[model samples]
Target: MKKFAEIDSINIKKNPFVVGSAVNPNKPEYTIYLLIKDDYLFIVDCGYFTNKRTKVSKWLTYQLEMPKAGLPWIVNTIENKFFKLSHEGGLPKDVYHYAEVVDGEKLMIDRPMFLGTRENPEPGYEIHTNSRKEGRTPKSLNFTDSFLFEHGLFDLFKDVAQKIESGEFS
Candidate 1:
């Protein structure tokens, strides 16, 4: 049972779009924001220090619609940017837990048997170096899985603007 990095602070605010936030307990100065903007879902991973503040450590934008093969197309547009940021060397590496607020209820999806777990996971692909550990392991990182899980909810609201534009749904 490895000890994974826990989410120290988390705040979520909802409006026409949902903004979900998670702070790394291992690194208090670092945070990740998952937002739904228009037809796309974005993951903005940022880091800041006393001397210098980073603009955007990592930014990933994924299309809301599913592919023809019935798969979510989540892509990390910003590549290797997070590596340059200052941290304990293992940033997202320590953060592997995930949670979501649905219908005004906060749901915990951190278990390994959940939808976004190793045994029964979500539909998509991820590029991670470490294997999924039983508990929160420093070497076990699941940032990609966490993003995809949140994106699943974001996808539900993505077509609203488009449908409104076409006057199909009001």
Candidate 2:
């Protein structure tokens, strides 16, 4: 199969084109590919199941395509968009929410719970991103879940999606 970097041109009308990719700095087994076709975005995990014959893309390739300064805003904007979308669906506005706690002698803070299981009882892992959300509820529209955050691929995915939406990458 063709690798992402080797793609020089794409017939987006026919198929989604690879816009960028990210690899987990901590886990080599985690990698993601971002693609766009028309106005929709798609992310594919090409990390665990691949063999020697399965082509993969590199995070460095995506970094090299854009200026370093663009990363922060791109990430923030994407997070904001995700937060808003989730909020509209009755999901919490915060992908992660912090709660304050008190110890007898000292105040303490708890780390934010990411898409806490309390909100959605079914396990997230039970459904692949490729599958539609259960009940096809409005919440399903908030498809970009905490998996991207936990995996450190959220910013990369957002940055790439922003670039594609801005017509900076086609």
lDDT tens digits, residue span 76-142, model 2: 4344533456646423554432112111111111123233245553212111211222255211112
Question: Which residue pairs in candidate 2 collide?
Answer: none
lDDT of 1 by residue, 1-170 (tens): 12223222232233333444565333446555444443333334445545436554432222111111111211211122222333533225534333333223222222232334455454322222122333553122234334434544234323333443454422
Q: Candidate 2, residue 21: CA error in Å?
A: 0.9
The root-mean-square deviation over C-alpha atoms between each candidate and the true structure, in angstroms, is 17.8, 14.8
lDDT for 123 (candidate 2): 18
Report, for all candidates in order, the number of backbone clashes.
2, 0
TM-score of every candidate: 0.26, 0.35
Model 1 error, position 133 (Å): 29
Reference-based lDDT, each prediction? 0.33, 0.38
Which residue pairs clash within candidate 1? 3-136, 4-136
